[model samples]
Target: MQKFFKVYIPIVIALILTGCKEEVKKPADSPIKENEPSSIAVTTASILKEKPKNLAAPEGMVWIPGGELKQGAVPQDKMAMQHEKPAIDVLVDGFFMDITEVTNAQFKKFVAETGYITTAERAIDWEELKKQVPEGTEKPHDSVLQPGALTFKKTKTSVPNLYDFSQWWHWTIGADWRHPNGPDSSIEGKDDYPVVQISFEDALAYCEWAGRRLPTEAEWELAARAGKKGTTFFWGDDISVLQQRANTWEGEFPVTNTKTDGFELRAPVKSYSPNEYGLYDMAGNVWEWTSDWYNNNYYKEVNTTGEVQKNPQGATIPFTPNNPYAKEKVIKGGSFLCSASYCASYRVSARMGSSMDSSLEHTGFRTVATVAMLE
Candidate 1:
């Protein structure tokens, strides 16, 4: 029988490129004015008129007027992964999404109410893990089975080898969502910061308790695009502008972070200007979990349908060449670790995946409520 094990691994890749360009000047902070003839506003208006009279948006959430979104990267996007190719149009229904990622304070409330224990706080199951490991492989020490989560520590020098992600990621005991760095660290005063070290199971549990659900990959991309279709970043194609618009690595990967955007680690939600759809931290902060099971060729399957996929829920099953036995889920928006010299997954169309049971220092999530839920 196929078995599953929760293994800690840093799945980010550092793509190094040359050619430094001049920094783009920051644009004036003009919020998306109401009554603007934007696609997002128009769709939202229509939905309000047609929705059930009792339909009301949940507090702390904004309506995403979903419409046709050209998902995936364009042919010219060199950084685009194979899975992000052959950009196709997809349609999703309007839904209410949290304006910011679920914050530490928000998650604390859920925990306080439900008395839920996150996966990281629970000990590993060696009996189940043996199924994934090759037969006869030595069992790890009992100490290794202790509760823990993956934590990122910047290296002392520039890492020439990008493939060896273990150079920066360390599995630390007691590093759950409550103690992000380890047992010693606490979220005490960082109530406004986005909660990290959250596994897919933890996020789902929070959603269930809150009467919400995680957004589908399609819905996530649509909201990240924020009515600006085909743009490299939500703000635009000029990567130089990223320093002012999102929280991303501004120096060498895994070694140095200049904190050019006023943050070396996670920033408080809404630290930057909101996207066109009034969504904050959609590009960078922490990689937000989506409800889709990951599959590299899912887009290919959708394209073969020869019609716009309405509310595509992503692949029916997860598949990854890295570890066939490990089930993975889609994660988007990149994080503080993303940089031009390293993991530049902050682009609107970029995607990443992690094991469903794995939790890390840079991963968090938001919740969504659909029209059906409202009714």
Candidate 2:
């Protein structure tokens, strides 16, 4: 079989070459829409046969009482990308999850106590960084290298199309979780907001300190679905009610924000209603890190077995034909930037792979604990 791709923009190619940008499904990979029944075989990873007793409930944590899960896009999600198809069934043990994303106040406390610094706070090592780029790529001067994170910038006018992500995403210097927008920006009075500009490493550090771990992809989907099996959007198949349920972009993406949802950027945790699991910001707000090493073709493997997997952790190593040099982890739950016109990653089964060291204003994470962790 012969495959060919047309490169419309050089900047996007450069971003892809650098392996710095967030993953977006190509227009060619757009989902098929029709009144179609879901292909997912129904099975419940549902319920613990016996609940662990005598374990005190952790603060701000809830047990995700599992039920049925179809661990991929349902037929109702017309916007689902090619990668989200071939939904499969799986079982997950009950685990306690943070009610909301790790908040600024919580991360601040961790930094204050441990004197730890985040990836966005460290100066860029061009030599190490360029490894992800081409071998002959020109290096910028030392003065140009600074610590920062990627941030979304609104374009003055609407772009011709949504294919070029670089039109809206920017790598700004001096931007971090504390200074979300930039060095000039501050998180003061927004302690309740989810922490952004957090890398996978940073999330792991926080999880370690909290005596919890990042949820596996299966765990994340199970929690988000919350027994609402074989449905789109985790809330239901209704895209019309997305505004009322999540803090996703509600206007011309990266151009004009109608603020229909009353937020132009990331909203405070619990700004929207929690799902059936009592977990807030699981569908949107900020993309949360997961423990899965994203393999672009892993879903195919899962479906081929035709057997239910138990407590399935994702691929042992990251695999994406787009960027082999970058070891990426799965980031679930879209962000405030996601919209129908852009990436509607808020769907429960929607997934994206981000570089392990990559940090952005729209990216954050939560923690989860097992019964053993408490006992």
The number of the candidate with the highest TM-score is 2
Residue 308 displacement (Å), model 2: 1.3
TM-scores for candidates 1 onward, in order: 0.86, 0.89
Model 1 lDDT per residue over 1-375, tens place? 112212332111110000001012122233312112223222332323233456676789888876767788754455666677566666678888999999999999999999999988987777775665456755667766678877788889877666556567677888999899889999999999999989899999999999999999889988888887667788878887898899998888878888999999999998999998789999888999999987878887776866666788888988765555557788899888888766678888778767777778889999999887877
Per-residue alpha-carbon lDDT of model 2 for 78-147, expressed as tens digits? 6677667677666788889999999999999999999989998997776676776657767765655677
C-alpha RMSD values across all candidates:
7.8, 4.3
Poorest 10 consecutive residues of model 2 by lDDT?
Answer: 1-10
Per-candidate clash tally: 0, 0
Distance from true location, Cα of 111 in model 2, Å: 0.3
Off by over 4 Å in 2: 1-50
